[model samples]
Target: MAQVVTCRVKFIPLQLEFIATFVYVYNMKEDRKELWDHLSQLSGNHKEPWIVLGDFNVVLHREDRLGGNPVTLVEVTDFQNCIDNCGLEEIANSGSQYTWNDKQDARIFSKIDKVLVNGEWVDQMPDITAHILPEGISDHCPLVVQMLQSFSRKENQDREAMRRIQMQLQLTPLNATIQKEEKELSDKFRRSIYLAESILLRKQSNLD
Candidate 1:
């Protein structure tokens, strides 16, 4: 009953657009072909920015597994070939490196879960971070992806200073001042985003 969920997202105020496809692949090896085919078809013709994430139930290399039977190249190649066919690149994640663990008598751990994106998505969010959270109620860990923040060395220092200030102010009424300042900073960021979006729309309308 598990299928893929595909949706388009548009940040109307920012006029930014991207598509996301979430897949819960078949667990059996033979059924993987069907999963690969479904993804390949979606990624085939268009270059729209896309991010696909889920339990793929397949791995691409030896290091992706620990203990149990070693996966043959023949087994891994199908998933690799499918990624190649779709021009999808896997997003590297930290935290729980491996996603699934068969903790029975045999005991096996595998990195069969993933988040992948196309080159266009890479161009859009070059420093995107895909992080893995704890596997709470399932065998597979949850993956979270977000755009990376860019900052100058001075800016980083400034943020660290602000963090220290916030920590210190936590015991004082100045904490209210810090909170107000944080709200103002957030509003400024939103305003900048709106300005950028207006400029993008204006330029696009001019071209039209």
Candidate 2:
């Protein structure tokens, strides 16, 4: 059985909007190909900033499985082909690299869960990441999709705010009572500059 749900999402704080699709798949080897084909067709139909994620029940690479039967090309081809055809790429992730683990003594682990997004999504939210939480009693780990505020976006907002403050300071006539307001504005402008520099340094370090 395979299920798919798609919806429009509005992130109010960031004012970011996009289409998100969730999929849950369960299929045998023969049926998996059909599922992949369906997903590929679905991706082709969507042109907006879109994200698709959930339990895919398959892996894309040999290293995604550990302490299990050696991964075969046949096991990965359909899923790889689907991703390639869909023009989707997995987002940056942290925490557990392997998302599923069998509880048995001879534990088997695999990364069958994934969060994938289209190029539009990447362009809109390049800093988004997925954090794989501890599985606990469940065999599959919980995935937390984090939409981080990009440094560029934050810097732009800060600069806009500072510009508004500067304009107000320039328009206001100098007076004894306005001295306090001027000082406050100056402090705010300095703080904004410092914050922008910090964000730039962090982005540079990440790139390095």
Candidate 3:
């Protein structure tokens, strides 16, 4: 019920090793129960930062269905139970209440697409939000994630690295040795700044 693609994202020179999983899930409840089982087993496999985004082919609540036959409690429970079991938190979206639409009728609207993240991802990106885009060629509206990572990361990393330097300096007693370490730490700090700036420039360039 899921076709998964994995990729390693790299920023040149920094050599950060980050892996991203792109999962496209088609959970047609009538088609199979395998998907429900898969969702139940997913959260146990990941204990670190992660995100899941795509058309889920399911809606969590009655509000997710705008003009369809009144959503059944069974339907809502089926969709939300998977989310709850997997420990995935849906990121609140702005701009649109629903994503999927029946091509024939504007009245038939449903929010089946979403962006879900785990506890670690939430801890790292508390300010992230999902941006629901206008419907395109497909019956589904596109979605974009507005992330605070690029803006907040450099500041937080710099602060933590400097804190480490400060702690090391405090713990080392001898004045001459302290100055020596301070100079070394200052050099390392400058390199960190340069790397962070390079990454910032790349992000700005991409945005432009």
**Winner on TM-score (2 vs 3):** 2
* TM-score for candidate 1, residues paired by index: 0.68
Local accuracy of candidate 1 as per-residue lDDT tens digits, 106-146: 76889988888998775443246778888887777777776
The global C-alpha lDDT for each of the candidates, from Candidate 1 onward, is: 0.73, 0.77, 0.68
RMSD of each: 15.1, 12.6, 7.2
**Candidate 1: which pairs clash?**
none
lDDT of 2 at 94: 96
For all candidates, the clash counts are 0, 0, 0
Superposed Cα deviation of residue 137, candidate 2 (Å): 0.8
Compare the candidates by TM-score and give the number of the best one. 2
| After superposition, candidate 2 runs with Cα above 4 Å error | 153-208
Give the per-residue lDDT of model 3 (tens digit) for 1-208: 4455545555354443333556565566654355656656766765655677777787877788888688888766766776788777887789888998888844789998888877665543324688999897888898987754453554466457667767777877566876676776566456556655666777778899
For model 2, name the residue pairs that clash: none
- Superposed by TM-score, candidate 1 places the C-alpha of residue 194 at a distance from the truth, in angstroms, of 10
Q: Give the per-residue lDDT of model 2 (tens digit) for 102-146.
A: 899999999999999987775444357899999999999999998
